[model samples]
Target: MGLPARRPHAPAEGRARGQGGRVMAPFPKIHDLYVSRMVVMTVLLTWTVLVGLDVVNAMISEFGDVGKGNYGLLDAVTYIVYTIPRRAYTMFPTVAVIGALMALGQLAASSELTALRALGLSRRRLSLSVAAPLLVLTALMMVNGETLGPWGQRSADGMKTAAKSKDMAVAQFSGLWAREGDIFLNAQNGQEHADGKDTWLELDDVRLFEFADDGRLESIARVATAEHRKSGWLLRGVKRTYFEGNSVTQTEVMEEHWTSQLDAAALAASASNLWRPRYMSARDLRDGINYRKRNGLDASEFEEHYWGRWFYPLNVLALCLAAIPFAFGTLRSGGAGKRLFIGIVFALGFWLLQMQFVKLAGVYRFDYRIAYLMPPVVMLGVSAWLFRRRSG
Candidate 1:
């Protein structure tokens, strides 16, 4: 009585028995690594295409300015090159969502997603796997925004300024010219300083030229250092020369209160690249917020950008998740071009929605953080509802 034949061990779970009784290979593991690679490759491809178009448009616009001052074609090209990092940083969120949608769309088109689902991988699980790579990319983009993006923007700005002006030169270590009424101001150099939790801008070798109504130079004041204080601008080590009929009278003072309508914010923005809240890092934004608050100035705009920066990752991921549902159902049978069109429309709609929320916040004077948060929160809710419906 021979031993009963084992039932071929039930094909060992994922293993399949062929006609010749040879066990076939198990289905390839579709873990985070495999999904992440697909998503990342698609994202890179999409980013390249989108960024290339954007750069070309920018080059065309920049080329129009080539003949202005000493700004030749080479200068225009150089300026565009310097700004690419910032452009990449700015476009990444849009690129990420579109890329993710295209990736999943391809998978669904190939029926790989159906296979994954049949193998016990839920849509939620696949969504997470896709998000993992984007999370890493978000972190990398944050760093790029802080470092290369701002640096490149500043360099581009400086290069353009230098090429466009002979007497007025702008650089990190150089100076910029600003005017208020008949008075022209120049700061030989400026630097941002941080003292504990407080931050401020200090200008060195400050010069102010006050012109008379008749176009005659009334007086020239020179200061060693100029600082913006809550009270007003404070000029230290001041020397003033009055030019009346070619007989100059010089007066020296240890300190003087500068009176002018020149905006401190504008000065900071022009003097240092770090002061532009739009391009500033989280740390710089925080410092700017603190400084504005301490000075009793309006900090709403800074707060808006600060909260926006912090919520960037959440917003991007939520949008991507919301976009994923489009790849399933009817879209599964659709062409890749159709999916891409849908992704673009979705991204544009989301951007418009976000802009509306921001505008509403400004109109109603609500907490800017709430404004920044609502879009992502709405996206996440929508995603969850769609996923639940699909799963059901």
Candidate 2:
């Protein structure tokens, strides 16, 4: 035996091989890069399609407002364009699911996933590979939401309002809520009124609840209208009720001058569609909460808004992770359209559940942090369970 026939171009006995005793390319970097590319590409494509549909729908809904005041067709288009970032922030999580599911489904359909598995790639590893790019995207979206989203939304609303009226004011479905040193105020409506040398913010049906340092209600002031003057706010047609031990004293005044720290600039900054929490940055939310706390007013709503904004990226990640198992199992053989449909259905369900939880939390007066975090925690738990089951 001539020292055993030497095999040409054959891998050594101890070397790892692919189906045969032949050398194979390193799968980790190659597969990871490939999977990341597929996910990112699909995400971009899905996001583009969804944004296009959203733009068309927005145009149709807003077109009726065209030609109102100075708001022409061009103005409407500009308003819609400016709001694209905000809408994209709202739609990101849905597209993340759709994109990841479609990409993985495509790979499964083509047997690429099967090949990767045969090459000793674990499902958990594959999941992480897919998640890495999504995590980066979530961070980017958070930045956009904090900066461009709010700015654009405010600018668009201001443009539309300015076009419609000389006074720049955005209509809110509910009303405006604000706070000063000791006064918590709710204005049913607000508009700017410019007269010669001065511009004033005219607030209608204003209610002010004055609180003491001990968190006791000192008095309630109801004004038919309040106007911002250079010196201070002038409340007209005022009815004030003082809260004392066991007895309440009520007095009516034709007009009273209200003095406080809240001014035109502060009110202008907070002037937004107040039916919902304003799209405030984390810093703004924190300062608002602190101001409310210092004034001995309830900061529950601000707390909720703060946590919701602060933890947005985590919530998005949880939602995206939850969709992975569905991609690998139910949608393994499905096409991109099927994946898209399923992703939409699931995304809608998630949104409904999240809204319900938030509302219920408010009704029950639960902790704001808990209320904001509950949905993401549940999603993360479900994902973990499904991932373990699949891996096991």
Candidate 3:
């Protein structure tokens, strides 16, 4: 079906014309916005399906102690909305790039662009008309990434925990590690033992130490199983091995538990939320980046994540730029299908390379700039060059 008409402009670009040899024609701006919006919406719908599949897949993987069915349909709707924006943001640029080109190329093929050009609408004006709305869109996407994306993630994660409570397995003790003032806990298993975002481990051989507070072993508690109740935790079959100045005290009991002050949801979110950078925004990515840096941990993954976020909107623009040359490059021949296939291959390859490089960056401690900047930089620069060559 044909695209719907362009909505009115946001007033800024709705001004009177004649900036250069020409200002953008109202129809061109209107047409481009209409098409770009359609492109974006199409991309978003596709994202919703794919992301929905992914969400289901993830929940399926954690098919442990399924404890949810608590949240209402509103829960699912909110989660669906939450999941889309960041993903949509990531994909929007590519959509705009490819979609804009496809739309324009279609227009050109049908002689719409040619007619407009003949009517004194230069290619420059046309590009400006198209890009101006896109810039605004990019900004809106960034905002969604910041506000809604993470909030949705937390809420959705909570629901998942409730659903997966049956499989709510706790981790067995995997020793202890500390950074800053807080120590990170790991168990043989971490799926259960808590509600919300936190992971409460049923430590097998618990080992803990705190340096900042007193440089002394504050308190060590080990138990057979730490069951997470709503307010706090209930540890069954407990033992406490305490250290005092070189003296050690041992206490054993049938049952014990600790109520932690930290937000369980946030902690659980951190542990389980690993590997899903698509849910994180640019700012969230930066926080993740900084976390790795402060821990003296290899941060290339987070660094790459940060770069991906920072360069993401630009990537969209780049993809659009890339499509321009390709659309025109293969234009002499006539098959939109081929261009699309090639674009898919290109997008996939680039994403795979990004994942591989980020891992390699972690392994080698490569410079953040080198790891993050190179791909988008190189791809975008090449795309720009190609577009110039085509237009020239």
User: Candidate 3, which segments miss by more than 4 Å at Cα?
Assistant: 1-82, 166-270, 274-278, 288-295, 329-336
Off by over 4 Å in 1: 1-30, 173-275
Q: TM-score for all predictions?
A: 0.73, 0.70, 0.58
Candidate 3 residue lDDT tens string, 198-293: 546333323333333645565565555544556586666766677677788888888665655534453454345433455656675676567557
Ordered list by lDDT, greatest first: 1, 2, 3
For TM-score, candidate 1 versus 3, the one ahead is 1
Residue 339 of model 1, lDDT score: 78
- Candidate 1 per-residue lDDT, tens place, 270-344, comes to 576434568766776787678667756566767878888888888789889888887778578778788788888
Best by lDDT: 1
Model 1 residue 313 distance off true place after TM-score fit, in angstroms: 0.8
Q: Candidate 2 on 1-392: residue-level lDDT in tens?
A: 45887665432222446676554545447788899999999999999999999999999988998877788899999989989998898889889988988898889888898787776666766888899899899999999988898778767876776675443344333355666877878776555667897888877678899999999999999998888888898999999999998999999999999887675664554353432345656776686678667746566666777788877787778888888887667777767778888778768877887778777877899876676678888888889899888777
Best by TM-score: 1
lDDT of each: 0.79, 0.78, 0.55
TM-score order, best first, reads 1, 2, 3
Instruction: Give residue 195's lDDT in candidate 1 (0 to 100).
Output: 87
